[model samples]
Target: MVKKKIQVLFEDEHYIAATKPSDLLVHPFKARSQDRRSLLRSLKKQTDLYLFPIHRLDKPVSGVVLFAKSKEATRLMKEQWNSENVSKHYIAMVKGVTETEGVYDFPIKTDKGLQEAKTSFKTLTSNDEYSLVDIEIFTGRQHQIRKHFSRRMHNLVGDTKYGHSSINNIFRKDYKFYRIFLHSYQLRFIHPFTKEEVIISSPVTEDCIHIANDLFQFDLTNIGNEAKEN
Candidate 1:
């Protein structure tokens, strides 16, 4: 298999933002017996810099991931993340038609026990089969979006763990989509050093655009283009 190069969205002395592909681990996991590829190692090899992950995307999810160039930068960025100052936005294609706009104010169980988690979503378009929605997460809980949507019976398309296999098979058979239909579309936070507000966004993947067009007749490409212009 050919290696997919990580797409860098923004980079500077203090930080780097890149698009992570699905199935790529942000850091090494000790539990997995087999040696697995990691995004941190790949980025370090590619840039020859000591990069520190300030935030993470789940292994099966793709899109905007942030890293700090130095430990000090990492410390500063983590402050923003821990304080809930960072704004995370995502675009997802799910199994059922959701409400036009609403918040999933639910708590999720973690190693630390139950924690308050909330996600706000607005349906961009939908058909009888599926809904395309924009999601904004207020708390960074493990698998929060997936769990919230799954609990509502609107699991994200291609989510193997929380989604129905029959629904996943439809997309796999029809559109050949195997990865989870969740992308980290945008990230907004204050630059720790400069005190400047920074917003970084990644365009929807081509596969996602094609699937949305074929399934719901929604043009995600146009939406991505418009976002670039703004």
Candidate 2:
């Protein structure tokens, strides 16, 4: 079987960002000859440069993933991510009709104990079964978005770990959806080297687009444009 090339979103001397497909790891657990499915590995082969992973999206989720071209670049970018200088946005399909806009400032359980996490969302559209939401996350805790929404019973569609089984079944059968309905659509930060603001957006994946349109009667082609305008 032939592997599909990962789509590059933004690239420069310091950083390279790409749209990560669902089921691909950002980094490998261990280096080996057969472990060829990771995004980091593929990007390295594609660009012939040693890439440093800047952030992560779970293997089951799809969207923007960034890498720094050098260690110095990595440190500077990580500083922005660790502080309030970064903005991350996502789009998700949840099991229930959500409010027009709201913030989930609940703390998430981590290895260090409960850490502060804030996830704010706006309902883009909805139906009797589910809703499409635009989300902004303030903290980069692991599984923060999934946990926050699931805690409120607004579980993301197709999220087996923290989702509604009945709704997952419905989408699996009716909409042919099989992956978690969460996407990191936009990322904005100050370029640590260039000293200019940079905004990068990844378009919704085809699988998510198909299910979203089928379930919500929405078109996802303008997703990137929407992120840029906002």
Candidate 3:
């Protein structure tokens, strides 16, 4: 059911973490579409109170998304994220075989300021052609993983901006996967209201898992596979 598919991994008096669907925009940008349902609108239907975002994941990316219930909670959550009190983790399906484990030591900046981003990754499964990766981010930056990991060599599978047409076509045409191969697999942070630490994780969407299983031999029942379905 769509009810179970749209799940809230974490929720409290002040905040909530909803595992987002792939290809859904976190917020509206550039041109608006008839099919577009702004994130705020969706959250509003969940509740009438004001909602705010602690951090934003890209439109094509899927997984744990945080929202604030009030102005005070919003500010507190933002502070926690900026202070590195929150830990971010993700899963990626890349173009080629990768190492068993490695760190993506890259730096990124935004208009307001700059921050050092550390992306740690490891190969979970491989078919000698493609690979499944578990990646973690020590700092938050826009497109940090998508850009740094995609430097020149074979890019992230289905990454149209940083990948080759041939590889993207493998997922698009062959597998009918249009969304990028990225998932916000986990989030760890202190609750704004209770001050208790929470570590929430999410499962990859069905389509993504099927693609990995079919092309890369990645089984859907990996260690973190039981996380809520996207």
lDDT of 2 at 155: 93
Query: What stretches of model 1 exceed 4 Å from their correct place?
Result: 33-35, 82-84, 222-230
Put down candidate 1 lDDT per residue, 116-202, tens digits, no spaces.
999999999999989999999988888999999999989999999999999889889998889999999888787888777777888
Scanning candidate 2 in windows of ten residues, the lowest lDDT window is 221-230
In model 1, which residue pairs have backbone atoms overlapping below 3 Å? none
Q: Is candidate 1 or candidate 2 better by lDDT?
A: 2
**Model 2 clash tally?**
0
Instruction: Please list the residue runs of candidate 2 whose C-alpha ends up more than 4 Å from where it truly belongs after superposition.
Output: 30-36, 225-230
Ranking, TM-score, top scorer first:
1, 2, 3
User: On lDDT, who's better, 1 or 3?
Assistant: 1
Best candidate (score: lDDT): 2
Overall lDDT per candidate, in order of appearance:
0.85, 0.87, 0.75
Flag regions of model 3 displaced more than 4 Å.
Answer: 1-5, 29-35, 82-84, 109-115, 152-154, 222-230
RMSD vs true structure, all candidates = 2.1, 2.5, 3.3
